[model samples]
Target: MTNVLSFEWKKEDYVTISGMIDESSDFSELFKKNHEVLFLDLKNIHRINSSGVRKWVLALDKLKDVEIHYINCSFSVVDQLSMVPEFLNKKCFVESFDARYVCENCNTSQTVTLVVGFDIQAGEKNYTDGPERLCPNCKQKMEFDHNPDSYLFFLSNLSNKKKTAI
Candidate 1:
């Protein structure tokens, strides 16, 4: 069993949340209370689903101009986060905030990332865990892996897009 804690508040038209986030209404209702940036805190959260992604998208649509953020999410959650369509940066800032580059060949339909971490500097960079997505069957670098391009892609584009953007 897991203990779930959540955080949500309207800060100048933004719903700030920090805790377990699933396909629950604790957020939609908050949206109804007031439309703002849907700030979701994945920092302490452990799990989520496509349904959770759907909920975030719906909330963003209904609220319009609402920004969603999921911080410090687990790697599994981060993997799912990366695959969500239109989900991007403003909503998916991995703790330690790392940037991942995607291979321009796999086409995103057949890539599965095993581990993720990164380091960077002016005109240079470094990352561990094989660059975000790999072929689940071939053990080779995949060209693409659905959407999200990276975890940050999810937090910034969680609504009205739902697919790879740029």
Candidate 2:
């Protein structure tokens, strides 16, 4: 069975989206109001397709005037953000997201939350310097699973945008 997308409004401007974001997902509510800042929680979003990406990009276009903060983004969402330039607009910011880590000793893998400004620094070459994480099984240091440069590439784009906007 396909997991249908769902949204929960935690506040007037904060909404949590879960399940799969596909062509059928409706984003009409996001464009209904004028908000100074909108917070979107995407930790539960498990999957997204090409049509979904197109639909999401179109929805974001309508929200260009609003400052969007993406919080608790899952690895899937991060993948989209890193791969697609249009996935993150100038008005959008990623507050926090999950990154995959693996322990080579025990072959254990886990996901850790990384806050943009705190855990991640824009110009820093070592993106893995965030909170020290140890593997649950082996009690050994876990290394970042993906390439730091590629997985965190969106930060460079965001940093460049901020510099030009200043």
Candidate 3:
């Protein structure tokens, strides 16, 4: 199957990426051809493979001047962000992203949108002591799906204050 990357022009200097990224993603051509794009929004991306990861890292390594802004990131994307520190180096920041929780009593799942610098602790990889949600099915307090230290590991490398919507 052909892996396709879709771009939506939000502005002359910004573009939103929606779709899966794989070995076929040629960001060099896209970035080289469109030098005006300084911001990339990865809110709608669904999945990315190892090859995609390698290609993305390589592309970003070349484009150090470009800033990446992650918004509405899916769980898979969050996993990648948390796992690979270079996936979101100092030039990158997350505006909003998805987080998951589970209720042990009912086995129900919940997904929450976490805003950077608000829901997430400043200078840390964990959420703030904000509101807690009850499981819809069992009315029990939900637990975070992943460990904060491990799941939000990407924050250690990210500098969120740069040109972000935060």
Per-residue alpha-carbon lDDT of candidate 1 for residues 32-57, written as tens digits (9 for 90 to 100):
55534444434345556666667666
**lDDT tens per residue, model 2, 68-159:** 88899998898999899999888988888998889999888898889776677654544544456889998999988878777887776765
- Among the numbered candidates, top lDDT falls to 2
Residue 92's lDDT within candidate 3 is: 68
**Candidate 1 TM-score to native:** 0.43
Find the 10 residues in a row with the least total lDDT in model 2.
Answer: 157-166
Q: Lowest-scoring 10 consecutive residues by lDDT in candidate 1?
A: 115-124
Best by TM-score: 2
State model 1's lDDT: 0.43
Q: Across residues 10-107, which tens digit of lDDT does each residue of candidate 3 receive?
A: 77766777778898887754465545226566667788899889988998888777666667777778889877777875566677777788899988
Lowest summed-lDDT stretch of 10 residues in model 3? 122-131
C-alpha positional error of residue 99 in candidate 1 after TM-score superposition, expressed in Å: 11
lDDT of candidate 2 at residue 41, scale 0 to 100: 93
After superposing candidate 1, which stretches have Cα over 4 Å from the reference?
1-5, 8-20, 32-39, 89-166
